[model samples]
Target: MGKVKKTRKNTYNYNVDRKKLRRRAKKKSAPRIQCDEIRNAWNRSKSLAGNMAEMGLVADPNKSLPIRERTVIGEPSKVRKPYVLEGLKAAASLPSKQTMGISSDMIMYVRHMVENYGEDYKAMARDEQNYYQDTPKQIMRKVNLYKHHHTKEYQTLLASRTKQ
Candidate 1:
């Protein structure tokens, strides 16, 4: 038998770009979360809640985490454990893509879950195209940039797009 050759995919070169993402991140005005922020804040919650079965913390979304009946805080006894902990748990359980927000499949899944599950439990995911797009004017500008670099290759690509 002859050996088969495998076709390789075109891998994007991130190395050809900047050395660090932080440099560009620091220049922004207000502190904004990055587009690629993945939070793992619920790992501890899951572990702790799992361990504390005696506390009788059920997985019901309507109820909150079961703290020991009485625990003492230093001064302010009126305060509660940060509400973000629950949100983190819920977000961790969500089946949405990390990069492009919510996909169509995820939306459909949400729709189904909302119908079958509880409407209060259902949440919408961010829905947008993952990749950047160039407007017609921007496309022309990019063509000009590429034409400036490699005139022959640029012309060939542009010509192919118009030939249909």
Candidate 2:
């Protein structure tokens, strides 16, 4: 072997002296000029006025004029209601009779089927309750309430159907 070239073990900044590297770093990171300092510099410099104009800041001291009068339109005062009161007001405004009618119809339909089917009504009612998304007790209560209110009409209808 003639002459072997020396290779660096740590290639990262190996050629640069540590002191020279630190000095270069200090020069590069000299201290950032703040907004106030930049503004003052821009105000003093005539050449920097164009650059400040692009940024639309208070760049020039002579050109900057304070607003004499400001027009502020007052917003309407809003009345804040409690969540419970708001919910109640919304509920009160809704057409609740329609939903009540639908629930009544479901109960009546189940009751009518129970009356027509007789002893086997429980099994049919179970399936009907599942379709109506109600429990057996709820369905029974509704059916019983319907029967109690329209006892005469219901009895007459049943009697008429049986006779036929």
Candidate 3:
């Protein structure tokens, strides 16, 4: 057989070492004159006199300037009353009503069916606690929802029943 070519493993540092060395070599070989001029120009522009020149303002050499207090144009001195607190108070005064999910009575009915009848959906449908008169399928669906929501409780109930 002919000599097989070796393959390198893919990694973050693959070929990075050689590229870093090449970059270092290139940087060392480059002239520093232009870099030094650019750095000096940057330092000059960052000075106080340079800043005043950029802003079209002249600095007075004879007298020291006084620091002026910054004033906000439209802000009021007094704190305003929050309207959100009033809305929250209004909401708190009203009685709360359950708008989503099954009612507490429905939950109690499902729990009764599960505890008394177990998985016997037909028996659950005929149960007096099932005031809605849910069909076998509807009873099964409600039982499933109850099981999903109260898994730990359902398991404990089953364990207690088995123990009895």
Candidate 4:
């Protein structure tokens, strides 16, 4: 004869109230004081005639205070001075692109490389304009530098190329 298998009895209560359990699990915090209550307390303290008030340290809250007129200080004098031509005029006249270390020739070279090789740095190195005899790595660096400095122009170039 085969041995009989024993059945396990269920211990968990299926009728337990989940809402009551959740309520019991929630953390209780102290009620916060309102800002108006704090302000009223401050006003009450200030209104009292204390030793600090007698010493003229704390101003009387009941007394009307003067409205301080805003005055401008350390402002430049309006007197006109003689016009001086500093070397800054030359720098100011130059184009924003010229301010970057990458020259126009280098930009043109990079543009040409991209237009022809389409990011093939080794092929770009073999191109006729690789007059500097820059290796593939050096050419890639120059291209990346150009792209970084002139992002908008590079984006436009790509967009135009895609349209073609």
Candidate 5:
């Protein structure tokens, strides 16, 4: 014969726990205060008088402290670059199929970088795009490769397209 199954029941009662909690809560109604003389010298006493003064109950905000002026020095002020519709227009134009050993995505990515960040190749490498996933050193190598192969042709193509 198979063994009989044992039944389980939840014995958790809220009323019993609630009564216990209320009894404990009543015991903590009054908080004990520490005398300043009994406390460590380094520790500040949190008396009612100190709290009231901290809330500006006895002091004027204006007379409390003088504001110090901040002077910026040794840093060149950032001047906004002139309007550049040409770079955007150039990047937007699709590259020709005749461009050797270069995918359209690579051309577009480089052109986009040039349009937005100019020759700041580190900024270009730090872009969140998959194409710019490589470290700055690797990206610089790729940029040098692009420059060696297609910089002049790309520039001429851009000049012609802009002229049109």
Candidate 6:
């Protein structure tokens, strides 16, 4: 006489667990993106973009830099975020007609900062509004303070991944 062996049936139907299975499959196939890798990617890609811009390889400086005007004109003394001030400075150098950063890299520099930095453009705008509303010199002071932090705090922050 021969003995018969029985196989166990599948407990989870393919349809019933399809979502979880898909998630598990995704997890197995794709690895997580680490913070350092992201920062490094930013470091690499941003400079490359700037270089491309500097070379005149890329068209439309506005497209590359894309600084949205966030500052509102205040009556008198007020706050002015350095980021906005920087944008204004770079913009001032732009050709009166259209082109930007004729002989220098100010446009590229500001573009890189806006693109790679941690703070949101919206936040910069809000700060500019508040600073401008307070006093005429507020924006300049804010810009100076922000620039001063570049020597100490900003370096540490830049070393880490910047999340918006």
Write candidate 5's Cα lDDT for 16-108 as tens digits. 778778878876753443533222221245554344243323224443343665332211232121122233355448586665586677777
RMSD from true fold, candidate 3: 22.6
In model 2, where do residues sit more than 4 Å from their true spots? 1-104, 119-121, 128-130, 160-164
User: What's the lDDT of the predicted structure labeled candidate 5?
Assistant: 0.53
Q: Per-residue CA lDDT of candidate 3, range 1-164, in tens? A: 99999999977767568978988998886534343223333333255444333333223433223355543221233213234234446766777675346667767887777778777888878877776788999988877777776788778776766676
lDDT: which is higher, 1 or 2? 2
Candidate 4 clashing pairs, residues 3+ apart or interchain: none
Cand. 2 TM to true fold = 0.28
- Residue 131 of model 6 has an lDDT of 37
lDDT, candidate 3, at 123: 83
TM-score per candidate, in order?
0.18, 0.28, 0.37, 0.38, 0.30, 0.18
- Per-residue lDDT of candidate 2, residues 1-164 (tens digit): 78998997956767779998898898775544454424333423344444344334334454455355432222112212233234446766877565333356665675565566542445555664456756556666766666676777667656765775
- What is candidate 6's local distance difference test score? 0.44
Which segments of model 5 are wrong by more than 4 Å?
1-100, 130-132, 153-164
When 2 and 3 are scored with lDDT, the better candidate is 3
By the TM-score metric, which is better: model 2 or model 3?
A: 3
Considering every candidate listed, which one attains the maximal lDDT?
Answer: 4
lDDT of 3: 0.60
Per-model CA lDDT versus the true structure: 0.40, 0.53, 0.60, 0.63, 0.53, 0.44
**Candidate 1 lDDT for residue 13:** 85
Candidate 5, residue 124: Cα displacement in angstroms equals: 1.4
RMSD of 1: 25.8
Steric overlap count per candidate: 0, 0, 0, 0, 0, 13
Tens digits of per-residue lDDT for model 4 on 1-164?
99999999988888998888876666332223343323223322333333223223233443424266543221224212112122235545768864558888999998988887777899988999999999999998998999898999888777776777
Q: Which residue pairs clash within candidate 1?
A: none
Residue 72 of model 2: what lDDT?
A: 22
